[model samples]
Target: MDSSTHKLYHEHDFDSRQFLENYFSDKPDMVFGDDSLTFLIENFRHVFTVGHINGDILIDLSIGSFVHHLYSACEFFKNIIVLKVNNRCIMELKRWVDDRTGAFYWGHTSTILQEKEENSDQFEDQNAKLRSAIQHIVKYDLEKENMTDPLVLPLADCVLSAWLLDVISKDQDDYIRYFRKFSRLLKPGGHVILIGVLNITYFTVGKDKFQGFPYDEDFVRKALAGEGFIIDYCKVQERTAVSDLIDYKAVIFIAAHKEK
Candidate 1:
């Protein structure tokens, strides 16, 4: 992998604080990630409405620095463990979850999700619940034979990953292999929720660009099926805001269950 693609996400170039300010904050023009949060919350509500997703544990596989995507899942499951690729990302998450220093703002994301649901949620209470739902935040290394090796992470009843496979990978083959590795963390008949930026080759973190696997919906479907998952729900959200920060055409959300 090229240095620019891989190194951009390391401590030097990647800033969790800047990440939120650019993407997750309530800024009127935060076009980098608003659509993704909106799309994920909508699909999460629909899936939970028709089906039962509650279980003992749900693992979030390398969610980068984002936290609010799991807000809806917290309603169905009590325990949510988030895994990240580096200590920077993990510490960034803990700052928010543990209410420590240097925590980036998530009120915008929390409020938006709470409003979409039927229940009325106070901003403070909602954030508290979100913090409570996250049980642990650990660092994960995909280069290990098993990403959760040494720790022996419990096989989760559900796993959630967003744009992880695309960004961490060097190529399509590596992406599929990484996807399969993450799938092993799920129990039989477990659900895996995935979000991807379709046809994107790279996206910016600060000023540097990082690689994105250029894959379409069909590639994702075939990859998941090959990994023994059955796609149950799928939604594609087109780019609504025009921004030069990222060059992606659409956002995809898929909920798939492992074959028993």
Candidate 2:
């Protein structure tokens, strides 16, 4: 990785909409459906449904403007607080939550969740439930002691993060440090659901490629145990999508609870 040719994570101007289209959209060009969208949604449904990781407030600190992961969650949690490091991602989320014009269509994701549960609910009704459940979408600064500065957020019953630590962390130490920050938001005995990619160097959004920290399952398990979390459920799906957009070899889902 040359310092001259490649841009740092902060240096790239991330476009939330373009990022969604490239990886998450249902179009023919998009190739991450089976690997990312379906994999994440199905795993989340399993955890929230049979895993019994239910709670009142679920705080989300995710990588992008994705709402698909929350479909299953909204059914189990009453209030969902979304925290974002990027303003663009925040705006994109707000656009969908508010049902503004030109908001990205997520009907396909809802349909996937519905099919997984073998339910007959319309996608529109499911989207409405998700929108109503999302109570806040606030900008956060990871460098700050209080990530949601001045807001003084309530301790969450469940903390959910997807594809965030790897993209933001500069090294393995940074990964654990950030994971500790996420754990702090969970109340005692509360659960934390983490979704991350494994053994990848970079993920491209638009024309720019941002760096990623590569780590194995053993490393993540140790990190969670170090933070006083008890592992409950873990699932890893081997990479099935063959695209240059990301080099991740697998996707991992982890459901763990804080040691009371």
Top candidate by TM-score: 2
Stretches of model 1 off by over 4 angstroms after superposition: 1-13, 121-124
In the range 1-260, model 1's lDDT, one tens digit per residue, is 35453453433346656666766677777875557677777778777667677788999874468877877787788889888876767778878888987688776777677677676644458677778888888776777987666788888999988877777776779888888888888888999989888887776667666666678899899999988899998989887767776677888989899989
Per-residue lDDT for 1-260 in model 2, tens only?
54235544534678899989988998997888997799998898888888998889999998889999998889899999999888788889899999999999898887787787654654558888999999998888888888889988999999999999988887889999989888889889999999999997888877787888889999999999988989999999999988988899999999999889
lDDT of 1 at 18: 64
Point out the worst 10-residue segment of candidate 1 by lDDT: 3-12
Q: List the residue pairs that clash in candidate 2.
A: none
Task: Enumerate residue pairs that collide in model 1.
Answer: none
- How do the predictions measure up, each by TM-score? 0.91, 0.96
